[model samples]
Target: MVVKIIVSTDKRAVKEENGDFGFILWEILIVVFLMGIILTLATPHFGSATNQVWIRIDSANRARIEGAVQLYRIDVGVYPLSVTDLVRAPNGMSEWAGPYLDEIPINPFDNAQVYQIGTMGQVK
Candidate 1:
């Protein structure tokens, strides 16, 4: 759609063929500028919201790992020495009814490393 504007006191078309082409360009520029401003103002909030979601996801993962550790201890009568023991049955342990976890969960903050377990059967 093309809009024609009359910039005269009499409100008559100044040039029908041209239709104030420069004015249209200026209008487009103004719209783009407004969009930039909006994006700039909104970007920080969006980033913070994304971080909050990651925190929640990691918190739940920590709880899940802690629960698995507790179960492992209850069955084996001691905390596993490492996180991997949750996902692999240790040798020479008859009471070890694991793979308590299907696999060690990766730390959300560090994808390459699995979550650590504390000496007292806590997930770190």
Candidate 2:
């Protein structure tokens, strides 16, 4: 078996002899930069979506609380003294419709500096 090898001195003949790595590095940097921008742009959208979901969850919880209050009102003659009163007995009652709720729901918007405003005024 005989092997033949040809060697060339032409600088252009060598692959990546001039500025190849630089261009590739630049391309990679550009791609990385573009990805960072994409993520940056998408961050607020994710936050907005999360906020919307939180609002929905909070609204549902508030509605459930209101329903519990209404049930308490029906059982009693009038509205309770406060939100906590709905979960507790009115005192001097032999029997009542409830234990209306298994447990009192917590205000979901407690964090994030959020506030809840009802018809009368700020409830929580």
Candidate 3:
């Protein structure tokens, strides 16, 4: 089989040079840089939100523990002598509340440590 094809280009086409491929790469680089800047601006806001959520969770746990202790005191007429006292069984005249809390609440900062127990009274 034989085939023939003809191609033609005008003088104007020869004078016109296409734009550089680098222009497209530069546009892409510009878009990436803008995204980086936007993310950098938003990072602190994300951190603040995370801290606020953690603090709210800590405060909620503290309030729950305090309420439970108050109930125990109302029933027994005194705050448990110490943190350990809340976990053990209660006996006579001691006027106790068994397991003041369903379970010991953990310190948010350090889950291994139990939340601190303080004296039952108002602050002056």
Candidate 1, residue 52: Cα displacement in angstroms equals 2.0
lDDT for 108 (candidate 1): 57
lDDT per residue as tens, model 3, 1-124: 9764334464334344343223356778999999999999999999999888878877887787777678677877877655555666555536665676667656656678666667872110
Clashing pairs in 2: none
- Candidate 1 stretches with Cα past 4 Å from truth are 1-12, 17-24
lDDT of each: 0.80, 0.65, 0.66
- Better candidate number, 2 or 3, judged by lDDT: 3
Q: How displaced is residue 72 in candidate 1, in Å?
A: 1.1
Candidate 1, 34-110: lDDT as tens digits: 99999999999998998898888889888887888899889989998888888888888898887877876666567
Structural similarity to truth (TM-score) of each candidate: 0.78, 0.68, 0.66
Better of 1 and 3 by lDDT: 1
Ranking of candidates on lDDT, top first = 1, 3, 2
Badly placed stretches (over 4 Å) of model 3 are: 1-23, 90-94, 121-124
By summed lDDT, which 10 consecutive residues of candidate 3 come out lowest? 14-23
Candidate 3's TM-score reads 0.66
**Candidate whose TM-score is highest:** 1
How big is the positional error of residue 86 in model 1, measured in Å on the Cα after superposition? 0.7
Q: Least lDDT summed over 10 consecutive residues: which range in candidate 1?
A: 9-18
For every candidate structure, what is the RMSD over all alpha carbons to the true structure, in angstroms?
5.7, 5.9, 7.2
